[model samples]
Structure formats: C-alpha cells, structure tokens
Target: MDNAATTKITENVLKAMLPYLRENYGNASAIYSLGQKSRAAIENSRIKIAENLKVKPSEIYFTSSGSESDNWVIKETLNPREKNHIISSKIEHPAILNSLKSVERFGNETSLISVDEEGFVNLDELSEKIKDNTKLISIMFANNEIGTIEPISEISKIAREKNILFHTDAVQAMGNVKFNLKDIDVDMLSISGHKLGAPKGIGILYIKEGVEISPFINGGEQERGMRASTENIASIVGIAKAIEDAYANMDENINYTSDLRDYTIEKLLNIDGIIFNGPIDNRLPGNINITLKDTKPQTMVQYLDMYDICVSSGSACAAGSINPSHVLRAIGRSEEDSLSTLRLSINHNNTKEECDYVVEKISEGMKKFKNR
Candidate 1:
C-alpha cells in the first residue's frame, strides 16, 4: 500500500518504453538515424507532457530525478554570495531542506515558514517572512507523508505580488492531482517519474519561458545547455505514457480510491487508540496516515510484513540513523507519537478486500503489541 514511495509501472508505459529499450537504442546526442529516432521520441514525449500540463514544450527540462530537479532550482537560482533569502515550509521534502543548507553556509538567509496542526502552510507567516532580500519561494504542491495538498494558487499570488520567484516540488502531486502551470503561475516546478508509475531515475523540471536561472549540470550541449546529461530514452518514454494514462483515467481512479480510502479509514479506526494524522479535507484521495498509540511503527511494519502486507513508517531511515518524521512533528505530533505513525497509501490497483486483509492483520498486531 505504499504507493506514495513508488508505484508499479503499468503495462501501457512498459509497451511505450520497449522500443527505446530495444530497437531505438542510440545516443540522443548522436547524428545517426537511430539517434535521431530517440531524439524524435523525446521531443514527442515533451510535447505530450506539455499538452497535459497546459504548458509549452520548451518549458520542460528533463533531469535524473526529482531530488536533482529540486537541487538544480535551489542551488542554481540563489547565488550564495548574493545577499538573498529563499522561503520554504518546514514540511518540505529533504531535497529542498538540505539544499537550503548551502544558502546558510554562505551567510545568506533562509526562512522556514511554519505549518498548522493539519500540515497546511501558514500563509500569513510566509507573507511576514518575506523581506527585501527574499528572492525565491518554493513550497510543495502536496506533502508526501501526510498527503496535505497546499494552497498553490494563493501561494503563487503571494509570490506574484512580491515579484519573487516561485517553485514547487510536485513530485507527489504530478499524476495524482492535476494542475495547469499557466493557471497556477509558478515560475518552476519539479516531478518524479517513479511516483507516477514510471521507472525511477527520471524526472522533470518545468521552467516558465521567461524565467532566468543558470545551468545545473555542466557538460557538452544537452537540455539546451540548461541540464547536461545523455537522456534515458526508455524511462522518458515510459513517463510520458504513464502521465497520459493517468490523465485519461483521473476521475474514475479518484472516485474509486476515494471511496476505498474512506471505507478503509472507518474500518481501521475500530482499533482502540488509533488516531488520524492528516487533514480530513483538502487531502489526497488515496492516502491514510495514522498513529497507533503505544505501538512502535517499525515493529508494526515488521509484524504486518510477516503477513505479506507492506506499509511505510513516519520515521526517516538514512545511513544508520532512525529518527521521528519531520512531517509528523511539524503537524504537532509528539516524538513518541510521531514514531508510531504508519502511512497507508493505496492506488487504483488496490481493492477493498486487500484493504480489509490489511486492517485485519494490523488489528491483530495491535492486540499482540498491547498484550506484550
């Protein structure tokens, strides 16, 4: 049920990518016919993606991953030596937070606007934090852990009024929630293919036509001298097809998952000491993050895995360190409670029966934990 972390690539996406993997294998930068075929595929994918997002194809820049896209925007846009500030929320992905460290190292300022108990950004605080030196504002379109969809239009309006550059990490929101770049008015945006049923290691950075920023990766001409690297043609084709499929079935998928999600929530809440973590409204359709009182999330995860059910914890596991999730903490969860969070993200492929089995196993685990 951990669709938020990644999704299984659909057959349609796989079929579209197969040609690039087999017959169309060639360097997109080369001059041979085979290479030109790859190039043509890339351009067609770009146009299709642009049409889906309601933006020009020229605005799309492919990157290795969403993290790379986020880093490119933060590191390339704000010159460390310049007296400038960038604003983001406390609940953003590590990609944004870690990149901001470079800004602080150079004596420049960064403002982390706080979020409310439901994980929505405090717009008034964001507005108050902006100063004369504030040059960029990057908030996420939707949070990955809690599934809280932020107010994108309002945030863009705030940035527009101040003439500050606005960016959003839409990695989690790309196929799940549809928004038009022309209407949202964001200067830049980032998305990952893996989150939307394409393979990992492919992402997109959408830059408004007139927006100015330095190149991220430096090498021989590629990505129009903006990002330098040979493209992964197969994954690029996969992402394009994945997005097309997602858009076509968006409403049906939304309705199906929304109903299953509400049903699952009702069933799971029957367990004593269970509590919901994220907002009930303005939330993603297929997400259910919750805390099971007095049970460690890691232990619960293992217990469920034994029954062949997969879920994710709210704790961050990096290197050898395991810490409570910054997301749960930002939303007013205590440290111990934060460690008890379990993220259950369902998709269209999941059925109500699977959710019932998951709930039954979880209920059994909670009982076992309580008895112990």
Candidate 2:
C-alpha cells in the first residue's frame, strides 16, 4: 500500500544488472574496452528511457535520485543572479517544494498557486501568477499523497503561450501512467527508478531539445558536461529494464490494480466517518486516500504495522513528522482530517485478497481506537 514511497525491485531488473555489478565493473569514463562497454550500456539505457517517453536520446540525463533531478532542474532554470520568479502548486512533493525553498533562499521569487478542493492546481491562479520575470512553471504530473493526476497538457499549453519554461516532477506518474513526451510540450520532466520497481539511486531528467539550462554538477565532462559524475552502470541497466517492463504491461497492470483499489475503497467506505480525498475520476488508478473523522492515521498505521501489513500516513519522506499533511490542507481537509488521513497506494503485485485483508484490519483498528 506504500508503493508511492518506493517499490521492491523486480527480479528481472536485478537479473539485468548483475553482470554489470560483477564482471563489467569498469568506470564509464575510461577509454579501455571494459569501460567502453560500460559506457555503451549507459547510453543504451538512456535510449531505452527516451524511447519510452517519446523523446530524443540526447534529452535524457541520469541523476542519483528524483530529489536530485528536481533540485537540479529548478536550480539550473532559475538563475539567482537575475530576479527570476517560479510558479508551482501547493500540493507538489516535498522534493519540488523544498527545491523551490532553496531558490527562495537565494532571493528568487516563487508563487505557490492554489489547488481546488479536489487537489487539481488552479489554472486560473497559475495564469494570473505568471509575471514578466516568471522564468519557469514547475508542477507535478501527479500528487503523491492524494493521488490526483494534474492537467499537465493544459498546463504546458499555458506555459507555452506565456513563454515560460515548464517542468513536471513526474516521479510518481512515470510508470503508473501512460504519456508521450512528443504529445506534450513541456520543457523538462523528472522521473525516479525506484517508483517503477527499479532500485533507488537512479533517476532521470528529460530536457526537451533547444531548452538550454546550466549544468547541474560541475566536475569531469560527463553526461555531455550537463551533469558530471561517474554513472552507476548497474542501476542504470536495472532502471531501463524496469521501465521497459512497466510500459510493456501498463494497460494490464493498471486495470488490475484499479479494480483492487476500487474494491478496497468500497469496503473501507462501509466504515463510519470515511472521507475520500481527491477526485474519484481523475485520480491515479492505484491510489486511495481516505480519512476517518475520529481516527489518527499514525494510530492506525502503528496497529497495521503490528500485523505486518505496511502502509503510510503520508509521504514516507515525512514519516517522523507529526505535522498535518500539506496535501490534505491544500484540498481543504481540516487539521483533524489531515491527521486522520491514510494513503493506500497499490501496485500490480497487490491482490484482491490482500486488499480485503487490509480493509478488515482497518475496520478492527477503528473499533479498537474508538473504544480507547
């Protein structure tokens, strides 16, 4: 149910990476035969990802994590030397929000556009927020906590009309949703491998052609000098294989997981004081967010963990924080409801039986907590 945090690496992806981790252990920068082989593998992975996104191979740049990708794109696009302003929504993942804060620290202005109660970014507010100095409009393809998919194409069109650079933190939507970069006119997008059943430490930033931004890391002339570092060949191979598998089985997996998610939602709704957050029709197929009016999510999460059933109160990155979810607040959930919210994000691996068991546990926890 915590697939949003990260996913277990698929066996096939691990198999594809084993050889590189052992026998082909060579730095991609070396001109030797073994190193050249590693370099070729890295380029191949980049091409594979680019093809899946319907973008040119040269546009793909790998990073250590989705957070790094988001940070780099924002930092590069918004130069602090100038009075550049950025526009983003209030419900974005912490990675994007924190990156914006970093720019804000350097005196770059930012406008966090409001969202509707359903968690969709207010396009009117966004359009109004853009100024002559607005350099970029960064929004997430989907909300991590509430499972709301944004109107990305519409947002892109607005950005294009206003001549502002657009970037989407698509870390949560890359594998779970089907999209083509050629069909959308965004300047840049970010994706994470771990969300798609690849290991952590491998992420991608897609920069459209002719969109010039400064280099992220400054060192050896790697990644065509845009990002300079020794590439992780094994993880790169794993991410490529994982993304390939994801697209290959996208329709089938989405249908199956959506059925499970709906079934779980139906059963959970039978409980008292159940409030479903986010739009039912415009949400990710695998995500279900709900709040029990009288219950705290952490209390239910602790009880669920006791049964060895994993779940999350909100973003796993904010696991220890007692603060109300920023996403719920954006959607107009009261502080009480925000504290009571639970995010159940499914994946293809989950089954109807497993969802039923989870619902049962939640019902039991509600009873136990109510009694207390």
**Model 2 misplaced stretches (Cα beyond 4 Å):** none
lDDT of 1 by residue, 1-372 (tens): 988888888999999999899899999998999999999999999999999889999999999889999999998887656778999999999899999997688777899999999999999999999999898999999998889999999999999999999999998888778677988989999999988899999999999999879999899788899988898999999989988888999888888888999999999999997899889888888889999899877788889999889888852222123777888889899988887789999988999899999999999889889634
* Residue-by-residue lDDT tens digits, candidate 2, 1-372: 799989999999999999999999899999999999999999999899888888899999999989999998888987657989999999988888998898888889999999999999999999999999999999999888888899999999999999989999998898788888998778999989999999999998989999979999999988999999999999999999998999999999988888888889999999887888998877888899998778777888999999988899988988989899999998898887898888899999998888989999999999888624
Model 2 per-residue lDDT at 345: 91
Candidate 1: residue pairs that collide: none
User: Which residue pairs come into collision in candidate 2?
Assistant: none
Q: For candidate 2, what is the TM-score?
A: 0.98
Q: Against the true structure, what is every candidate's RMSD?
A: 1.4, 1.0
lDDT of the candidates, in the order given: 0.89, 0.90
What are the per-model numbers of colliding residue pairs? 0, 0
